[model samples]
Target: MAKNASKGASRIRVGVGGWTYEPWRNNFYPAGWPHARELEYAAGKLTAIEINGTYYSTQKPASFAKWRDDTPDDFVFSMKASRYSTNRRELATAGESIERFIGSGISELGKKLGPIVWQFMPTKRFEPEDFEAFLALLPHRVDGLALRHVVDVRHPSFKVPEFIALLRQYKTGVVYADTDEYPSFADITSDLVYARLMRSQADVDTGYGASSLDRWAQAAKTWAAGGEPADAPRVTSTPAPDTPRDVFIYFISGAKERAPAAALALLQRLL
Candidate 1:
């Protein structure tokens, strides 16, 4: 499971997109769980959480501190980069927005901060030079805390060797989306692995069936051990260095109501 790996050892964290969901009140949350304590409850069950609200709006420093304090010491939060930084026509010109978002109290998360996902629109195409310029804008550190960046490029144009090369050059990861709706690839480009699984089915009690969850658990272990899953699709034939790396897997999209159950189920398998 590697969930309690020693210092300097790789860890595998499984979680859902976010903690707040209306449907979760009836299914995942307790009968009288207060809404204000949802983050605390979710953090106890899940190892990590992807903060989706940051994608739509800016948050105050106090909010980040409160979130940090509400969770367990081992809990992590992967924030979605602002839409203004990734949804624009010219990504190269998003330096100001990127700076604004990063400087907007995210450092308050401190050691609990995980990857920052810069999710591009589905219609956004890959432009080599412009994309490189945008990647250059991502700072390696924020307030002395190391920052990890991952790109969630949905367009098929990103399925190329050049795109992978750029990511590898910047040491930024490409989100390994486990879904048919986007360009899914497993080329490892950084020291950490970030995955967003979106194929959850509503009819399934655990979002994904038992076999699928088992496979994902195995895949996560393989990634943490610095190995690629043989079944995963890749755009580049070149292999990444086989070195231990931290892995973050989040059950996102699809049957959103079942995401918490899916995360918990996966965590159980990891154990």
Candidate 2:
């Protein structure tokens, strides 16, 4: 098990990946602008969402305000850090760039900024010097704000235990992605678990269409209740279940035009 498993809550915070295509436009409103209404609909069922599109394009202040107005008070958003901050660019010399990006994002989103997701591409192999310099460039505190940092290392070679340790040192959450392009959930290790369960398997798609939704809701309950296999394994020296910890589960199979339907399927399961 990873570090801080004891401190984190077990009750999974469920949600789908970010929205890309518009589904409500046909019936709800004209195509575009205020996506908050869509967010509100999604949040009514799921507790959280990972904002992937934000990295592709920055949102205006008015847009963030509208987003805040749309979603409920308890709902949380997990935003991706800008590509310029984590992509092919070298971080040591990019200190000014990183600072600028964070400053802009914070300024625009305010309270809705959520966790800063630094998702590196698989092509960008792990270089200790670059990574250390990169990590150092990140702002410890952004304008009196303590931003939550979550790292998604897509490179396979970057899965070294030392890399995980670095994440621990920064107190950054590591993304537990179930993807063939990068490392799998079992290979990746981190204290703060950010699981992205993409529905790549055929069973997942079919399952979503069937009774899997019910199963997820039930699973959510089970996870919330401190996980099953109640008794600690007699052989191993793993820590016993002491208290529940918060788990974030994001379903991502909705990249298509049928996103709303996918979102709805996930919402049904989450609800």
The model with the greatest lDDT is: 1
Task: Indicate which candidate wins on TM-score.
Answer: 1
Tens-place lDDT per residue, model 1, 10-129, is 898889988889999968999889999999999988899999999999999999999999998888999999999999999999999999999999999989999999999999999999
Q: For residues 1-271, what per-residue lDDT tens digits would candidate 2 score against the true structure?
A: 2211122344356566664445445532345546646667666655677887767876666766666677776666777777877776675776766777676645444554566778887788878778877777777677676676777777777767667656656666677664565675322123334667554344343324556455544544554455533331112233324345345667665333333444456555544
Give the TM-score (vs. native) of candidate 1. Answer: 0.97
lDDT of 1 at 223: 89
Which ten contiguous residues of candidate 2 have the minimum total lDDT? 228-237
TM-score for each of the candidates: 0.97, 0.71
Q: Which parts of model 2 have CA positions greater than 4 angstroms off?
A: 1-11, 23-36, 105-112, 185-191, 200-245, 253-271
